[model samples]
Target: MTVSRFYSPQSIAEATAILRQQSGCQVLAGGTDLLVQMRNGVKQPEYIVDIKEIPGIRDVTLTNQGLTLGAAAPAQSVTERPDIAAAYPGLVEAIDMIGSTQIQGRCSVGGNLCNASPAADTVPALIAVGAVCHVVGGEGVRQVRVEDFNTGPGENCLKRDELLISLFIPRPGVGSADAYLRFTPRTEMDIAVVGAGVSLSLDPMGTVSAARVAIGAAAPTALLVEEAAAAIIGTTLEESALAALAAAAGAAASPISDKRGSAGYRTKVVGVMARRAAQIACDRAQQRQRRAH
Candidate 1:
């Protein structure tokens, strides 16, 4: 057995320097995914750069701007924050549903994002809320929208030398809320066949003023369904509006059939999930409206 060399860096610069010198070095935020891949022979890394000890990567901070979620921040850490839970419940739901109860404490959003799995629950949710990824490297820091972060399954826009620092989500406006839902073969420990997330802002007149709809596991990457979002933007999510949203969602998905579900089935089911998620978001938006008055 070849022993994998491990380095735990306290600073971002130090970490990047190590990565710059090494080839095929794996960044360990939460080892939940990395360890599994390694054991399964899917990944072979000579060096492991552990960033959980880094100052900014493990913290969950709530500010007036929004949540500054460290890339290494555990799902449990994010879920435990009452402010984050209250602010982005849809994100909280996605983060919390990563794995089993015990695994959540060790699963980081960064790991989930970096894994770039098509079925990742958090990707669609992140897109729905317009989160940005802050990545750092020897070259410098750069920001990317979460929606554009993933290029394909098991691939992302990150260069080998770069590391994600944190995720930033702007504070939702008043009368705004979000929701996430996914269909899986099993309730727990099963990958999603399809996932849908919706975030919407309601005007005082109960019309959807702003909205975002994202679908996951139905394409090469998590897809931002602009047409689906447009369907409900100027109207309440009535059945007619929802029907249009579902139609758009179905048209946008390009899934491949597998043991979990057929391509056609996934396409149809994702539309349903999108409509359900939209309804949940709209309901929550109304609740937010009530709370503000």
Candidate 2:
């Protein structure tokens, strides 16, 4: 058995320094994914840098401008904040599905995103809401859109010396809302066969003024489906628009055949999931509009 050295860093600079010095060091936020991979020999790291000890890494802040979610914040912590839940219900729903109750206590959204799994439920939702990743490194801090963060399966844009700090999301408009839905073989603890997330803003006349559509488990990385969003942008989410959105979603997906489902099946099902999620988002947008008045 290979014994790895563990270091708990209390500051971002300290953590980044450790990451820069170590060649094969793994950052541990929640350890839900890392520990499992370590045990299975999927990842063999010589050093483990625990960033959970960093100040404010687990804090959740919400303001009028939007939200600043700590990268290491646990799923349970995010779900417990009523302000966060109300402001981004679709994101909350995705976080809630991270794992079971026990796992939720330790699973962090940052870890989920860093894991870079194509089926990560939160990635699609994050992309739909236009979330941006806050990263720090030797060169200083920089921001990357959630949709552009992940490069491929189990890979991301972060450099060896970089660390993700938090995520920022702009405040939704009065008539804006979002929704997320995923298909899995089991009800819980199973990878998504397909995941769809949609966010839309409605005008006073109920026309969709803006929209974003994203999907997971259909490619090497979670995808932002601009064509799907374009399909519903000028309409009131009517059946004709939904049908077009679905078709666009199906067209954008490039899944592969596997045990859980086949490529053709995933392609077709992603359309259904995207359509349903859009309907849910539209309904939520209407509700937001009613409440704002």
Candidate 3:
């Protein structure tokens, strides 16, 4: 197998035009996943349109709505953003845990989501933060919630010629914090057996105002447990509430037995991770609230 044709586009318009004109053309961002798949003969694209050279695709900006992370922005870039780390620690933590420093240098969040791996670390964090994906195609642009982005394992709603433009993460309020946690056989360089991220917001009276909990690796795509979140809203987190949320989180998982972990273990760990992450996020949220006062 050989990559015979490579097209490097200088602009998004050129990339979109190339994609529309070429058949079997795979859009290449960082090539961290695509190159490996191609080399392993898992995928063989007739044309590779390299989008890394396109300008303005790597910007990370803080906006009134929240944060807009460009599709081509490297993982290292996302992990190092002080604003992102301070505002959305779960996302930063997840980004830090992805691959190694070298791999992070070459991996883009868009590429990670577009790859649509069941265990992708960033998905859970994104889902917890209520992130939306901006996609562009010949039909123009549209936004899809991160929760709805992945259709299933290794599959997403993106069309053949559509490209992910950026990710939009809503800003957490002043009294909010987020945490991401994952369990694996070894630390670093290993895919998660089960991963969870939680974002919690406290009201002025020290009660829970809003919450979002998302789990990964325990489901075909990132799973949002709304019922678990509802269990904690409108009150300070209690042990019993946390337990209920954990159980709900575990019950929502639909995992399969695989070499990395069993479905039972995945379910149990998803609960543990979700509970601990929620507690951690609550503590952090309290600290942020105190600091703001």
Candidate 4:
């Protein structure tokens, strides 16, 4: 590890100013990922800008419009909120898989995202739910779709001087629900071999209305598959529609062969995962719809 200067920025302005003025500086959130990288010598920064001290950066606010999750909010804190879980169950499911109970106290949803791992559990869920990254820098603030935030493995679109402030997720409508599923070697605390997230709504007539499907661990980044969603958007989620959804999801995968699974195996598995996740989402949406009526 390299010797580094640490700055606890008390505000967003101070954080951004440090980022703009300092070279080779890295933002420290929950540090579940960054600290490990530093210890392993994968990352050696000259300065560490700890944003935990920033006001409102660790808060979780949900309004009539949507959810605003602070960049440094602990995973446990967010997941423990009944309102958050009720509104976004798929997202809660993903965050719940981040690590053991001890790690969850220190890990964060935003940090998991900024790590930019292809297999990060939360990315696909966030993308499926239409989550947007709120970025701030000397250039000012901008909103980026979560799907577009990551460019590749361990890489994101944020400039060196930019900081991810928070995440904004749109409110799910009536008769809508979501689900996430991942195939891991173990039942717990293992990386995903292939992950799928589905968010969908059922019209009053029980036909599919709006839907989004996203796949992770089978691509350079989590991908939003329009074709997979389109496969079931108009019809009721019948057997044929699910088969098409699986096929489209399989066709979208571009994975590298690894010890856990082969490229071909992952491609096929992601499709299956997507199909299953979609079914789960559909079932949840139906249940919600029944209650709404």
Count backbone clashes in candidate 3: 0
Models 1 onward score TM values of: 0.98, 0.98, 0.97, 0.99
lDDT of 4 by residue, 133-236 (tens): 99998899999999999999999999878999999999898799999999999999999999999999999998999999999999999999999999999989
Clashing pairs in 1: none
Question: Which model, 1 or 4, shows the larger lDDT?
Answer: 4
What are the root-mean-square deviations of the candidates from the true structure over C-alphas? 1.0, 0.8, 1.1, 0.8
In candidate 2, which residue ranges exceed 4 Å CA deviation?
none
User: What is the C-alpha local distance difference test score of each model?
Assistant: 0.92, 0.94, 0.90, 0.94
Provide backbone clash counts, one per model: 0, 0, 0, 0
lDDT of 1 by residue, 1-293 (tens): 14369999989988989899889798988899989988989988888899988897888888888988899998999988888888999999899889988998999998899899999999999999999999998889999999999999999998878899999999998899999999987888889999999999999999999999999999999999999999999997788999999999999999999989999999999999999999999888888889889
- Per-residue CA lDDT of model 3 for 59-87, tens digit only, reads 88987679988898899988888877999
Task: Indicate whether candidate 1 or candidate 4 has the larger TM-score.
Answer: 4
- Model 2 RMSD in Å is 0.8
State how far residue 292 of model 3 sits from its true place (Å). 0.5
Q: For candidate 3, what is the TM-score?
A: 0.97
Cα RMSD for predicted model 1: 1.0
